[model samples]
Target: MSATRLTVGWVPLTDVAVLIAAAERGFAAREGLDLVPVREASWANTRDKLVFGHFDAAHMLAPLAVATTLGLGHVALPLVAPFMFNLGGNAVTVSRPLAAALAAHGGLTGDLADAGAALGAVARERLAAGQGPLTFAAVFPFSTHAYQLRLLFLAAGLDPERDVRLVVVPPPFMVDALRRGLVDGFCVGSPWNSVAVDQGVGTILLLGNAIVPRAPEKVLAVPAERAQAPEIAALIRALAAAAAWCATPENRADLAALLAEPRHLDAPAEVVRRTLDGALVIDGAGTVRSDPDFLLLGANRPEPRQADWLADAMVAAGHLPQDAGNAARAVFRADLYDAALAARTRG
Candidate 1:
C-alpha cells in the first residue's frame, strides 16, 4: 500500500504516547501512514508549527484547540480535535519550602478540597504579611494545567487572579523555576512533576484527577479541513491502538524507556514509570501515593462536556469572549471521533 505521509508536532510529555507509539510501533504503518513525529521545544512552537503548515497535525492540549478557535492567544485558525489522546495527567507541584509551610499551617493533604481550602488560607497570610502573592506557573495561558489550578482555587473561594499570581513557564523549565523560587508552585503535566519531586526541589500537592477527575488533557488535532479526510480515521485508529498498548501493564516500562530517549522527555525511566503507573513519589523521602486512573488513555472519545467546561473556564478567566462555548463545540469535533471510531469498530 502507498502510505499517506503526515508529520505531527509534539512536546515530550508522557501524554504524547499516542503520537510516539503510532510512529515507533507498527500502528502508523498498519494504518497506511508515514507518520513523522517531530519533537518540539515548547507548546507554542508546536502550535505555531501546526498552524504554519510545518506539521499536518499535533499532539495538542484540548483547551489550546478551543482557545485557538476563539483567537484567545494566537491567530484565529480553526483547529479540530477528533480524538482526545488522554485525560487526567497533570499535577501541581510546589517548592519544598512552600509545601512545608502549607503543611505546617494545616493546609496540606491529598484531598483536593481540603488542600485547596488550606492553600487559600496560606494565600491570605501571604497577603497580610506584605509578601507578594505566591506565584503559580502553567505551561501556557490556554492549558489544562492553568484550568486545573484555577478550578482548584475557585472551588476554595480563592480568587486565582487576585490572591495568587499565575505565570507561564514551559514544562521543561518548571522544575528549575520552582527550585530558583522564580515561582512558588506550578501545575504541569507528567514527567516534569516527577522530575521535580525526584530532584527533591519540589513536592506535588495535587494530581489533576484530584482537582477534576478525567478532565480532558491532550488530543489529536488538525486543521478543520483535514478533520474528515480518510487518513484522519486511519490516524485516529492508529492513535487509539497506540494508547491501548501504552495502557497495558507489561508495556509501562517499555513506554518509559522509549520516552526517556534523548530526543524525548530525557528524564529517568524510574520517574516515568511512576507516572505511567499512577504512583507518584511525593517527597524527598520517596513517599509514593497510588492514584488510580491518573491517565485516562482508554476508549478513544472526545467528550463535548470537556470542551464546554474548558470554554466556560476560559470565559471565567477572561481569556475568551462569551461566545466561546459555541466555538469549543465546533473545535472539539466529537462527531468526527464517533465517525472514525465507529467506522474502525465496524471493520
Candidate 2:
C-alpha cells in the first residue's frame, strides 16, 4: 500500500518558488511522499488552518512562526521552520500623492535615521493641515513587510503607531487599495510591488534590503509534532535537496517557468522573470537595473536570522516586548535545518 499522503498549504506568491519546484520537479514524489499543494486565500486563513491541524506544513512568514511560537501576538503553537524558502523580495511602495509628498520633503534617500526624520516631517505637516494620518498596508501584522515599513518610519522619526495607521490588506488587492486612496503606502513582497509599479498606481519607496539588508523572508514550516514522523522527515530532506538545486544559476530559468503555471502564481512569465532578474522600473520611469540577486532560493547561506529582527519590529510596532530576542529565537529550529542539509548531502 502507498504511504499516507501529506497536505501542505501555501499562499500564492513569488517567493513560494521552492514549494512549486518540489511539487512539479518530482522532488516530493521521489521521497515517497504525496504532496498536495492547497491554495490559500489569505495569510490569516493559512495560519489558522495550520494551527487547527488542517495543514501538515505550510509556507509561512518567518515572523509569523516566531510570533505564534512565542504567543506574542495571538495563537501560540509549536511551529518549526525546517528550511528558509527565499530572501529579499519585499519592497515599500507609496501612492502617487504620498510619493510626491515624500519626494518634496527632500528626496527619499539616506539611512534609516534620516528617512525617519523626513517621514516625521511629512506627518507633522499633514497633521498641521488637518489631514488624516497616513495609512499603510502589509500582508500580516507579523510579516517581514510590516517590519520593513516600521523600520522605514522609525528612520524617518515617525512613531509607527501614533503617526499613522498600519493595516493588513491581502497581496492581490494591494494595487487596488493604492489606486483607491485607501492606503498611502505599503510594504509587500514581489511581484505585488512590481505589479503596483507596472500598473502605474504606486511608486517604489525602498527595497527590504534597505531596511534590514538581505533579511530572511519566508520559511517552510511544519508542525513540530508531525515533523518527527519518518515519512515527513524524508519529505523534508528532499525539499532541502530541491532548494540546493535551485541555488544553481542554470536551474533558475527552468524554475521560473514551472512557477508560472496556473496552479502556481498564474502570473505572466515576464513578471516571474523580472522578479528573478530584478528588472525594476523606478517611480514610473521605465529605467531598469540588473539586480540578479533579487531573491535567494536554496541559498548556500546560514538560515535567515529573522526571528530577533522580526520580534524587534513587533516591539517597535508595540505588538510584543521591547526585548523579545530570546523568546523569538526559541522556535527557529536551526538544528532541523542542519539535519536536513546532512540528509541531502549524504544521499
Q: Specify the highest-lDDT model's number.
A: 1
Pairs of residues clashing in candidate 1 = none
TM-score of 2: 0.91
- CA lDDT, candidate 2, residue 13: 81
Taking all chains together, the TM-score of candidate 1 against the true structure is 0.96
Q: Which is the leading candidate under TM-score?
A: 1
How high is the lDDT of residue 95 in model 2? 86
C-alpha lDDT score of every prediction, in listed order:
0.85, 0.76
Residue 37 local lDDT, model 2: 79
Clashes of 1: 0
List ranges where model 2 is wrong by over 4 Å.
Answer: 1-4, 108-118, 300-305, 322-324
Q: Model 2: per-residue lDDT, tens digit, 1-347? A: 58458778888788887777787788888887788878896788888888898988888888888777766656678777777788788878888777777778764563455556667788889988999788999999888888788777777667878888899998777888999999988988887877788888988777677677777888877777766677666767767767877777788688778877787777677777677777666568765644566677766222535666666766777777766666656666677767765776787
